[model samples]
Target: MASTTPTQIDQAPPVTSSGRSTGRAGDKIFAGLSKGSGILLLVIMASIAGFLTYRASIALSKNEGNFLTTFDWNASANPPVFGIAVLLFGTVVSSIIAMAIAVPIAVGIALFISHYAPRKLAAPIAYVVDLLAAVPSIIYGIWGALFLVPQLNGLNLWLDEYLGWTYVFDKTQVGVARSLFTVGILLAIMILPIVTSVSREVFLQVPRMNEEAALALGATRWEVIRMSVLPFGRSGVISASMLGLGRALGETMAVATVLSPSFLINGHILDPGGGTFAQNIAAKFDEANEFGRDALIASGLVLFLLTLLVNGAARLIIARRKDFSGANA
Candidate 1:
């Protein structure tokens, strides 16, 4: 038997100009498409920001109230007084409350689905969670307004009675619990499914070998999860929580339906009135004139900036942890 020479073994296959040109053309087309898409996204974002800033400047110039500190929103007045203090307070407070409630519950549910649940039960539960994520926000709003508000009255009373010393829970006046706290609860329920789904997916991706090693070292199921799963999924959970936070921040209908709009800043979240940015816009848009619309756009710009800041912070945290995780691995 004759052995092949080195040159013969290392010989390159013949290439046709037609095939090479076709491949080059395909590559150029794909590269152009991707570049164009990214440019288009940047352009769209810039356009939105520029338009909002221009309108906001016009409205601010005509304003009779401090934009940052004033509580009233009377844009239709001759001097057109308006400010975002109340809206900012409500938006941030409600979002914080929602995050505090939602994140832990979501993590627990994700853990249960990923590790604790019976194999037979996990699939169905996960399916239900996915279904819940797809349910319309308007449905949540309607349910929150008609059913949740009434149902929460007892709990609200109980909290005010027991936890009123906290001041945040204190309800001085007699009224329904159509407040920021209620809105927070509603937002928690609305965001729960998405967070759980994302966290579960992350947990499920944990390497089985890592868990098995922990088990072999006499670690219990919870111990294995703590040592292996949680660390691997920390970034994912953070991302999921941020997604839920964004949803809570921008939610309109549910907040509008559940919250009795007020332009005042109240520390008591169980009381009957507080307002969020999206809720404020939705509630006042139809009655607003051109200047009023500009003011709303300005508020929207604030919301947009807030979301960007949150996402940027989360990315920074993830980047910092990436090196630590890589080193440990």
Candidate 2:
């Protein structure tokens, strides 16, 4: 064989004085646009939050009691004073209930869709879930009010008869399903599709190599998912839960229509008391006096804060998890 001649090497283009190449202008513009958009969003969010907080502070300053701590929602009184404690309690409780009911079912549905289900079955089911998510919230409210409420009342009645010993199932035979429990159940149903869809997407992203490796190691399907899939997708599940909580917290018409908006906060889920922030706002916005409206705004501010806190916590958890996983890897 003839001796091979050495190939010529192409010299790299010279770098600009600014440490960037001429070809990077488009990239720099794109990055600047992206960062500018993010800054604009942050500014808009901050403005809205500041306006709401300012209004809430004005309303709160006029009230006699410490608005944050007091449980009474007597915003329409002679003194025109009240607190969001009841609303906060209701919001937190209802959201917790919604997350509890939606998350497990959503995760199970996601697992089934991404892994266990046959291809033919998956498409139709996925379409159905998407359809469910697209359905108008008002439609959900009406259907929930007319259809689900009565059906649930029947279920509640059965539970009353059989499981009333448990505090959750106790019912006072109200003519309508206007309780926190009913609202929470409806919220769970409304948010289930969102959680399931997100979780399905997350689970689908689980590396094929991981699954194949587990199987090659003689792990069963369920065991493989339990070890490799779940741990990987756990952060995604938490993010989905937080997203669902945000929806549940901000939900207005559905909860308003489904629940009885009493100022009183009752520990019993079955009791016809306790009103969430969005419910309180929706129920009273039209009829509420100026003070009542401002008080509602104050309650909304709390809810906004609560949602921000929840989302932040979720992000932090995901970040820490990524860090730990990265270090391990």
Candidate 3:
């Protein structure tokens, strides 16, 4: 064989201005398409915000009630007096209750599926949980209205009897359990599968080597999970919780069905009457005139802003603790 010259061996192909070695046309096209898609999404979001703001301003200009403090929503009256105070309270309170109820159970189910259960058992359970997420919200609404509402009456009574001192649980009125508390419970059930699925995926992504190292240190299974798995998946759990909360906040039919709509912002969640933003819109939109529709849109805008704030807060929390670890070292 002939020996190759050093200059010939060192020779290389010329690169384009883009600095890509091969410079394939398809790569540039794909990159442009991805960037364009992202920009399109931002544009769409901006357009929606601007449209809602314009409509809301029109409605707010004609309002007779204090938009922030007034609890009544009488959008068809002489001056079209409407306010979001009750809606705001109901939405936030129910979502908080749902989060309080769902997150722990979801985390437990996720941990069980990821670390505790046998493979055969976990596989079926995970499949079932994912399938539950595919069920329509309408079905949950119907179920909550018919079955869950009646079933919860007993629990509501129990809470009223035992935990009545808490003020929030005090229910002096006698009626079916169609309160914000019931709505919250229904929301918890509705959001459970989504949170569980996301958390399970995050838990399953924990490195096997980290788990094994924890075990090598003579840690129990729970201890291993606490030391190696949970810390890695904490941000993911927060993300999952936020997703569930968004669903809870925006849920219309279930809250409308489970909660007997009311304009009053009572502290007794177990009492039968409260309204969420989505519930109010669904219940009132058909009866609304042109300005009333705009008023509803205003409430929708507030809901949008609330969701954005929640997501931003969650992202901030995750960013601040991105390096958190359960292990001291």
- Using TM-score as the measure, which candidate wins? 1
lDDT of 3 by residue, 1-329 (tens): 24567666567544445565454788898999999999999999999999999999999999999999998988888878899999999999999999999999999999999999999999999999888788888888889989998999889989989999999999978999888898988899889999999899889978788899899999999999999899889888998898899889999987887788889998999999989999999998999999999999999999999988877877876676556633334
Candidate 3 lDDT score relative to the true structure: 0.90
The TM-score of candidate 2 is 0.85
Give the Cα-based TM-score of candidate 3 against the true structure. 0.87
Give per-residue CA lDDT, model 2, range 1-329, as digits (tens).
23333222234444446675666898899999999999999999999899889888878888887687787767778687688888888988888888889999999999999999999999899889878888888888888888887787677777777888876667764667677887888899889998999889988988888778789999998999997889888988988888888899999888887776787767667766678988888887888888778878888898899889988987887776665344234
lDDT of 1 by residue, 129-187 (tens): 88888889889999999999999999999999999999999998788879999999999
The TM-score values for the models, in the order shown, are 0.89, 0.85, 0.87
Count clashing residue pairs per candidate.
0, 0, 0
Steric clash pairs (candidate 3): none
| Whole-model lDDT, model 2 | 0.83
Question: What C-alpha lDDT, on a 0 to 100 scale, does residue 202 get in candidate 1?
Answer: 81
Instruction: Kindly indicate the candidate among 1 and 3 with the higher TM-score.
Output: 1
- On lDDT, who's better, 2 or 3? 3
Q: What is the lDDT of residue 21 in candidate 1?
A: 66
